[model samples]
Target: MSRGVGLLLVVWLLACSGVHAQALPTQVSGSVSEAKTRLPIPGATVQVVRTKRGVVTSTTGDFSIEAMPTDTILFRALGYKSQRMPMGGIGLSQLVVRIQLVRDSVRLGEVQVISDRPDRAIINRALRNIKRPAPPVVSGAKRPPKPKPLFAVDSTAPKKPVPTIASPVSLLYDQFSREGKQRRKMEEIEAEQRAEKLRKARAEYNKAFLDNRGYTP
Candidate 1:
């Protein structure tokens, strides 16, 4: 009976080793692409289902991950439907997988963009109202001659051509009118003042000369 128990224990150990060998992780490498176009999908997520093991595809849509035969591999990417494949058939050997993802066809709502454009009418009106600047004056340019006044007087007068004869009425008015008498009186008074000033000036000069000569009057 003890021999039989030893054989059963040995059989149980062999079964456990076989199971552990089958559960060993395998290096899985793959490329993901679009279903319709067959174009490579970079940055695609390659994750082992029911575990945290995952990897992201490279620019060439290539990925490498360690996964057990019992685990399921999930491929996900933006704008594409998710895909899953069981790793059981691949076994412990290194395998390269090519997965094609279908495009998600859920249409998005239309977007409206409003641009801030000034009104064309206002712009045209502003352009029309803009006053053009006057032409620039050039230096050292000859200027046009200025126009003369309507009633300009000439300073150069002609020689005597015709002498007007005064009438008796005009001659008597100049000699006896109140204005004429006042004017004659003013002229006489101006002449007397001039004579008095000249006499005083001549007397001062004679006195200065006699003093210089030591003469007494």
Candidate 2:
């Protein structure tokens, strides 16, 4: 029984020592800034090199991450060179770090572009070489000339009598009527000409009136 109690005490001590050796996770805070300007760099990537855990900086270039003392942190941002820092020697529970990022310069080479378009003249020459069939010709027998009218008009058929003026009065009346229509048409033409002349005279008078009033019409 005494031996068992001694063993139990040894186990308890070992468990307590193990719990004491394991450290609690600590929060690390850091800011990324430009090296020359010393201005905060936002949206920077902060990653643990060993565990692959990562976080991004806020708009104010501030970041907080849970990390162990044995981990190494990596900082990266656009237009800036990447930086790696070891966290083992940092002793504070809430560690605050200020990181400066250097600018990276890149040089590009000249580039040339070339284009080739097919020749239109060569394509047209190729199309003209293709053979085509000739148009068909129409060939048929000629129709006989139409035969003469079967027979001369039958002499036995009565002839239609020709009409003639029965009296001189109708002819004279028709002549008088034609003369009257011609005279009326002449009068109408003269009236239209007079009206047109009057219109032209009115237009000239109006133009003169406007000119006298110091206005051009």
Candidate 3:
């Protein structure tokens, strides 16, 4: 009986000294969220600083980890500041510890936009080379009379036999006459307008190219 009492005392002393505590790891469960909005931060890493082992928070921002009182745990997530806490501070009696992480601001470096087209200088030069046609100058030229219709149509007068088809010689003369010169001038004006439109279109395209890349020049 005395021997049994002594053994019981030794067991009680070992229990009080926490000799078995090392074998029993503390279960640490917690949640992480955005501090300002109180929104759960899923995929956040909960790592043990000493062991480097970690666990990721669930979609609901819930996590469970086994750690010792002496260990330090770190909570980290993308786009948010990391947090550290001592395991001892999270007492065993505490249920779910709520960890709210502040949003971390990240500044990015300058971004370079690459393209296959020519640079600004080359594009500008190309646009400048497109020239408008000059207006024609007809010095000492008189306004030519309108040509009469080849065949006149009248209901009151009896229709005469169809006039002979215009001779080839007359056709050639009309093509090289003042009327032809005026037609050519009108064509030059149209060409100038078309060239101006093309220049404007190119300028607009360059502006848009720069704007899309956030470039100014």
Q: Pick the candidate with the highest TM-score.
A: 1
Over 1-217, each residue of candidate 3 has an lDDT whose tens digit, in order, gives: 6999999999999987675564456788979999999999999999999999999999999999988767899999999999998877443533468999999999989999998988999999999999989989899999899877433433343232233466666556557779856766776787688667656655665674645432122
For model 2 the local lDDT of residue 80 reads: 93
Return the clash pairs for model 2, or none. none
Q: What is the TM-score of each candidate against the true structure?
A: 0.48, 0.46, 0.46
Q: What's the residue-level lDDT of 50 in candidate 3?
A: 93
Q: Is candidate 1 or candidate 3 better by TM-score?
A: 1
Among all windows of ten consecutive residues in candidate 3, which has the lowest summed lDDT?
Answer: 154-163
For model 3, the superposed segments whose C-alpha errors exceed 4 Å read 1-12, 15-17, 89-95, 116-217
Model 1 ranges off by over 4 Å: 1-3, 114-217
| lDDT string, candidate 2, 1-217, tens digits | 6999999999999988766544555688979999999999999999988789999999889998877777899999999999998877454567888999999886669888765866899889988997898877658857689766423333443232333578667556545678756755776787688667656655665674545332122
Candidate 1 per-residue C-alpha lDDT over 82-187 given as tens digits, one digit per residue, 9 for 90 to 100: 9998976455668788999999987989999987887899899999999999999999999898875433343443232232365667667767789877877777
Q: Which pairs of residues have clashing backbones in candidate 3?
A: none
Ten-residue segment with the worst summed lDDT in candidate 1?
154-163
Report the number of the highest-lDDT candidate: 1
lDDT of 3 at 167: 69
